[model samples]
Target: RVMYTITKWIEHKLGLKVNATKTHITRPNKLKYLGFGFYYDTKDKKYCARPHASSIQRFKRKLKQLTIRKNTMALNERIRQLNQVIRGWINYYSICNMKTHMMNIDKHLRTRLRVIIWKQWKVPSKR
Candidate 1:
């Protein structure tokens, strides 16, 4: 088809190679690019974008590393560090309308922070 011809032209004429393993010839809704997933919104009858599940998982992994209790950092210092990272991540993905997903992430982050604080307190009486 046209795509095959274009790939051949690029390879032969331009001396560029295409990685077939990463290529997708499907609808935009089925393709993921730059940590974002595209999907067609039935209600709006338009295309929409959201962070892919893998991207969210990666973010959570980083957050978990930052929140680990063994770091021994002061509570204020830990919050400051987490704030910087979360701010940058939010800014980068702000274009995607993922309010619900963000809410869930925020809730999970709060839970992690609470657990870290409890561990720092070391006792129910202190907590």
Candidate 2:
């Protein structure tokens, strides 16, 4: 009923045709909205939103590109690029509730950096 009403309103009041194939009823938690996922907060007694999983995966992919093992750029340059990516991503996602997820990402990023540095050293003794 709600969807039908909305569709009619769009067609009549807004003079816009609703694309039936693109529309569906779903709980907000099941959909990504502007890279955010909405969920009810039990402790806060309200609702909240967080950076969606696909956004996090995109961030990881970007970091992977920056930290590829064979990229011969100096480690410092790589770190600088990483810093820019992390800072910009965090700044945009700061409003979301994702402390634990961020911490895990930080740990993984540090491990990747370590691997890059280790690869640069080349010799077991030097590493």
TM-score of each: 0.81, 0.83
After superposition, the stretches of candidate 2 with alpha carbons farther than 4 Å from their true spots are 14-17, 123-127
Which 10 residues in a row give candidate 2 its minimum summed lDDT? Answer: 118-127
What is the RMSD, in Å, between candidate 2 and the native fold over all Cα? Answer: 2.4
Local distance difference test values of all predictions, in order: 0.86, 0.89
Tell me the TM-score of model 2.
Answer: 0.83
Highest-TM-score candidate: 2
- Could you tally the backbone clashes for each prediction? 0, 0
Q: Over the stretch 1-127, how does candidate 2's per-residue lDDT look in tens digits?
A: 9999988988999998789987888988788878998888889877798999999999999999998998999988998998999899989988899898888988998999999888988877885
Check candidate 2 and list the clashing pairs.
none
Off by over 4 Å in 1: 8-17, 123-127
